[model samples]
Target: MTEEPARRRYDSLRRTAQAQQTSADIARAARTLFVAKGWAATTVRDVAREAGVSVPTIYAAYGNKNGLTWALTDAADLSADLSRLLAELESAPEPPRQLAAMVAYDRRLFERAGEVIVLLREAGRTEPELAQAYREARARADDAHRQVLSTWPPGALRSSIDLQTALDIYAAICNIDVYTELISERGWSSEQVEKWWCTMVIRELLEIPTAAT
Candidate 1:
């Protein structure tokens, strides 16, 4: 009967919603442990305990800790404001303003990923799949950089600066490691980091005219 089919469809939708909620809860719990302790140190049992789900459920949902790690990382990436930043960066005409936007966008990015980034990087040393994931994340960042760089009309960067070198400079200065150093060891506030970063990007990377004394 049509009524039977409709009932089944409703039940299916409810089940799918419940499953997605469960996965989200597990990923949220896993992120805390992975950030507080390294991913290598956090076990499936720990996540299950944190999430108030059974160990079997955790295994059934994520297969293992690595799967959960990927789930967390991927979820964060999906939730970030990268698309908006990318669009804004690409549409901006002025090179100095674009560079400022890039610096600000990266700072916001680190505000989200900066906390656990070092853990992910350190785990990559011994975990092959996580290493691949880390590489893919960096590749995505590189692609974003390339997107803005390629869209700039002529005279955006110094005529003498090659594209590849510019990209390398961008990555090196805007990287998470340097961001961590600024926050953790150097004791720079986020505002300070943002200002210093913008200044460096203009001075070191951009070809703005030198101010006459």
Candidate 2:
């Protein structure tokens, strides 16, 4: 009886491993399709064909194209990277320094997030599921900012800038779309853009004097 139970357990572990491998393959294929055809134009069948698997296999592994895309998003490490940055913000010694660190982190995130950004923009037009995921991610980031603000020392600084304004400025400075538009589209250098934006945000929203300028 014990041997039978052990065999069953081993079989279950093997099946779970196979399923995870299939899901990973599907996600990789979906990312390729997304990049080649854009998220709106890519279909589950396209991903299945690209992956050299049956459509049912893709669906069974990922539930749907959106699920596959979500998996791809996870693979990209965007959320994990952002979460780490947020944690860094929480641990930084001072608010102004934390804000500077946050801006720098945003720049790094944008550099690494080009493909995910493209997918997100495409999703905004035709994929409700992706758009919803994007919004939820933004909301989580916003919540993190709010929690950070809650630790601010009570004073005129806290009184002058409400949490909402601080969150909005943080969101604007951290927004990849805005960064792309200003830096990539407008030909502003990353350093120039971040410094200027960070200065303005710190001054206006947080009433914090930038150390150097």
Q: Which candidate wins on TM-score?
A: 1
Question: What TM-score would every model get versus the actual structure?
Answer: 0.68, 0.66
Residue-by-residue lDDT tens digits, candidate 1, 18-68: 454547767668878877777678899999999898999888988876677
Q: What TM-score does candidate 1 get on C-alpha atoms?
A: 0.68
Model 2, 4-95: lDDT tens digits are: 44344234324433444446667667767777777778888898888888999877877887777565554344422544554455446366
Off by over 4 Å in 2: 1-32, 40-64, 72-80, 83-87, 156-158
Itemize residue pairs with steric clashes in candidate 1.
none
What lDDT score is found at residue 113 in candidate 1?
63
Q: Report how far residue 59 has shifted in candidate 1, in Å.
A: 10
State each candidate's clash count: 0, 0
Instruction: Note each model's CA RMSD in angstroms.
Output: 10.6, 10.4
